[model samples]
Target: MTQDLFDPFAPVPETPAKSGNTPEFSVSDLSNALKNTVEDAFSFVRVRGEISGFKRASSGHMYLALKDDKAVLDGVCWRGQAGKLGLVPEDGMEVIVTGRLTTFPGRSKYQIVIETMEVAGEGALLKLLEERKKKLAGEGLFDADRKKPIPFLPDVIGIVTSPTGAVIRDIMHRLRDRFPRRVLLWPVLVQGNGAAEQVAEAVRGFNDLLPYGHIPRPDVLIVARGGGSLEDLWAFNEEVVARAVAESDIPVISAVGHETDTTLIDFVSDLRAPTPTGAAEKAVPVRGDLIGQIEENGLRLSQAVRRLGVEKKTALESLARGLGDPKRMLEERNQMLDNWADRLPRSAVNVVSQARARLNETSARLVSPREQLSEKRGRLENAAVRLDGAMKSALQMQQARLDRASAGLRPSDAKRDVDRAGKQIMDLGARMGAAVKNTLTREAEGLARYDRLLESYSYRNVLKRGFAVVRDGAGNLVEKSADIVTGQGYDLEMGDGVTRVTAGDATTEPASTPTAPTSGGARDGDDMPVDAVASSKPETVSKPKAVKKKDPQPKDDDRQGSLL
Candidate 1:
């Protein structure tokens, strides 16, 4: 396999320095010498193109490449000048690169030591992410302290995903098979260009509801999709999504793509799941174990109840055995009863006299309540009559007004007015058509401008600069430095996904790099499962069945690298 000219890991592979065969020394040594001389001569050089494979290095530097369709230049930014870059770079994006062209004498490779990088798409989403990071970081949303804990026993769980995908189905299935608790779903796009924004909105929507709304607030939010290439999953990397996840009052679980793929949301989320199915598992309570435990607890309770009954019976028997004889106790009780019975007649006489007086008092009091009740009834009847009269009067007034209005408008005049209005309406309709056409024209121009901006400074331009994309199994773009945790695996879409690659960047960013499809931690293999987000997963789930499935699709499915 051919080695990468800028493989940071490999011993700088030997480059055949001087082209052509006729050489006194080997081409490798000549190439090395030429590389050194050129690098030494021009301490700096400036190039214009798009940015690709933009990455931040551990040494407080930036590493990326610049390119257009025709050519690409490997580049780097040192610690000092990297801070000066006014714009954050993105793959396939166009930009102006200013740097010192030099050769690493050790590797005999040519590269640019970057100074200033500016996007003709300047201050776009990448810059927006940096700004957002600062903003949210300031708000403690990204802080470890403020993150909500995922519910251990969520009474109800809400899922956000595409309605047709396996994500919802899987979630429903798992939830049913397990605890069979309530599983609520809010369907949304999990992939594609709009998926991130939709996902973010759905998350916010759940939080926005009052108690009596259609869907309950999710105890844990699961954003999910199947597996795909990095570009395919770019929607999850959007900063809007990342911030939404970070700022969510409910803990979020990211389940985009396969195990290897992770997005910005992963870093900001409470948890990261490998797949939609996995996300379902994470959000759901384990059914089998929970039910078994419940049953076990029930049995234990029954036993405890029996034991308590036995203990109570034994105590009652002991008290009964310790008690005095029934005959002696009966005699004492009879004597006490006789004395009280004799006094009872006198007490009864006094009580009877007092009761008689109270009865007379109660009879007198009854007259006022009866009279008051009658008066209230009379008032209610009067109120009803008044209400009826008011309603009739109002109805009559409205009828009179309508009659007057109609009377004033003679039929001829009304018809004439209607005709005039018709003519005016037609004229307005024609004008509205013209306005629509003009609006479309303006919008078309705006779209063209947007395309130009993209061409001048988007991820595509960056890729031309010899950068590569590392996608998770589900094809989501993982941009955050924090997302690429150890043990995470991914599929790389190099310049064309056509160009072969031999290595990956030694991920150094803080895993907060915001991109289109942001997410949480890494999971398992690149299993292109269906969306389980919208589907249900009760504890009674079946095994992974043999089911037909469409391959996971990317945002720009029709993309073939065309200029706008």
Candidate 2:
């Protein structure tokens, strides 16, 4: 297979042998050599082509093929550089990329590592702007349903434009002449690099202002700028600025330039005022015109009221004329009143007679106040006398009972009771003392017995009674003859001390008088003489046999002594 120049794994081109020897190169060395050469030659090159296969990866790096009608070149913009381009690359966009040419060894291809990309000219910028416009329009930012109605007379007006430009002056002067309102001016750059971001941020900042904050929120917004060329006015055409205007909670008036100027923001805003001055006019009604209209309305209302009142008065007079003369009507009313007056005194006399009869009958039915008081007084006296007699009887009974109870509770009787209680207390104290003593004695006897039991089981006591403990070569207690190997050394601990000795075979002759060992001093691993074994029969070995030498174990100085 043919090797590509940029591939790191590609085989190096072979060189013809010169006198049976030629310089050598590795695949990686050749790839590096080619990469350096191309990078050095095109370190600061600029190429113009139409962008194709454009995409931004999740890592923010932008990749595209910069192609013409006949050829194509691979291009890449790193994340940082791509962000600073100020324009998102799209298919068919003609752009000029300035960067160094570099080879990707793994891919076996060369690509331009772009540091910056820009539209080739105004045409390319317009194409890019148009693509972006379509995208945002598809998202419904420019829909009429998203548009908010501008306030007819807002309490406060917020203007977003360059603070030092004529846009602000025109907007402010127009507002003052028309109708003065509180103006909140947000200062921002209207052109050049990062202008779109600043303008979008300004729009969001105004919207973020709290409705009841220390700084009052604007009732309506006026995004204005002075006249400029398409490049100078590109900030307003940015999708960021357009979307910002679309999402603003307050109504927005887009006034970017002269009457002929247009931008994406103009379509997205709630109202498109042709100029900054027009925006101000749209934000508020003219003060003089409003006052004039008010006066005209007032005049019309007053004239209508006068016409209505005059018509109603004329109608009333016509109705009054239809009635009879006033003097004859008054004479008839006077005659009727005189007749009523003549009958009123006789009716009053009859009512007075009826009321007098009712009073007399009521007076006969009701008892006199003096008689009622006299009866209540008689009842009170009877109750008082009965109460006095009852009190006397109660006092006599209480005194007799108290005397009887006191007669039994005398000083002598109190002494007798106290003496009896003292005798009982003495007896109880003596019996309690005897019981506590007996309990202590029984507990002491039990404790003594437990102490004796513990002492009887003590290792020292058992050792003192002519016994020795044997630990095998593994330092474990030898509980059976099977646990001991005949030739293995073991530790023998007695009441006085421990000694190392080898186990003797379990063979024995008839019991004979004890004698000294036949071997010299019974060296470790030496078998004890058959006459010394106390048993008669030899034990058969069942377990696997191993003879291990035991290391010397240190013992406390007090525990190191010969057995008596």
Candidate 3:
């Protein structure tokens, strides 16, 4: 007997056949045969081992190896079955998988095709739960600060639980007995496959409802379940359900299982209740007690207000008594006023008598106005006579001096001086006229030179040389052929006149015939046609007549003569 060295468990080969009776098999045929044999033999199995090399592919397929102290077995769970496995598979986690054994033809190896997988036992499940709790706690999901305060009295209370269970009924009955509220029941599976997902979705669904929508959104959420074993209540222990509770916008009251039954959700929820009934009680207060307290407070407030009003009235009355009588004071003031009025008229008559006597005495001591004026006129006549005598003496002295001075002069001397002044005036006027004539002549010559220079620089001189200035219809100078637009009108300015033309095909006729220069006598420089000058014979060309320059001589007119 010989065993294959590569595979210790492989079947041993029998003795060599004498004839060619041994059947030959290809690699694929052998692999398929082994796959069929392994599937048929272990069609259903449950394997218990520690997970190793666990990896989830991007395609959602999970690949891993299960190993014990002695040997290792490879396993694979397709995407469809992986989600239903309840717990996430991790490295070093002890698990139990149920599936069929199959062989891979390409690799020529045997593996288990897992359908369902779970933590191996209660102890293993507890270990996995503890590890998950530590991970979520590290991320602050279980912190007290992250938990929201539950509403004391919610208008709408949303509950997530199985519809057919007795747990929901107990909660509803308790709420009705205490303070009846509007309840929104979100039906979900409590335990089994997909139970965790349903519970998580129910929590998120209530939060998604709009506050002002047709259906009233709940103010608080209650997640309740009945008492059960650890395995039976495993759904609440799921990490997904715990995260959903932690992230809830509304406060949550966890009432899953009994008082002693703890799960991941209990640690994350805002509040925890021992039972479903307890959760309902925590949701709202008793209506009767609230009403009784309010009435008691109102009674106390009214009594305090009444007592304050009595104290204020007593204070006001005491202050009024301290004031004295107002009528007595007014009577005393009236008596004093009558005494002063009786004495005032007698004092006025005495003052008038004294003033009249003083006026009579002053008149007796003064002189009359008519007598004083007569004395002043007499003094004025005396001064006028003395002044007339002095004036006549001064006039006689002045007249004697004038007669002595006239005796030393002669009329011939006076006449000679007058004639000499008249001759000097005539000579000055003649010299002034000559100077003005010279200045006028120089100014006129300068003006004529400027006129000639301006004519030399004028464009008309170029026209006299047989050139014409062209301009567009808009009157802009056309210096280049590129500036001319086809089919546009143009003007040709010659020395004589401006002629209009149109730019068209090369063979097109002019728009208007240029008018022939008038056949009159030779014109002056200002109006002569340059074309006629250029066409004439050189010998017959007459020099342009000189422009008459204006004399700048000053004009004589009736005006004021110079004082000099």
Q: Model 1 misses residue 81 by how many Å?
A: 32
The residue ranges of model 1 lying beyond 4 angstroms of the native Cα positions read 1-48, 51-140, 152-156, 180-185, 287-292, 319-564
Tens-digit lDDT string for candidate 1 (1-564): 122333343243245446673225355655665665576567766688878898987888888888788987889888777644533466766677776787765675778888776555434445544555676667766677766778887776777778896667887777676667776677876654356667888888877765446766656778877777654565676667877787788888888888887666777888888877777677667767878989999999999999999999999999998996999999999999999999999999999999999999998777577889999999999999999999999999999999999778767877999999999999999999999999999999999999897665454433333233555555676554345444455554432442222222323322212211111111122122213211211100221211111112223423423311
lDDT of each: 0.65, 0.77, 0.77
lDDT of 1 at 220: 74
Q: Write the residue-wise lDDT of candidate 2 on 86-162 in tens digits.
A: 66677888888899999987767999998877778998788777887888888888888888888888998888999
TM-scores, all candidates, are 0.35, 0.50, 0.53
Where model 3 places Cα greater than 4 Å from the true spot, the runs are: 1-20, 313-564
Give residue 345's error in model 3 in angstroms. Answer: 21
Residue 485, candidate 3: C-alpha displacement in angstroms: 94
Candidate 3, clashing residue pairs?
none
Tens digits of lDDT, candidate 3, 456-494: 655555344434556777776675555656677777665
| TM-score, prediction 3 | 0.53
lDDT of 3 at 40: 75
Error of 1 at 390 (Å): 99
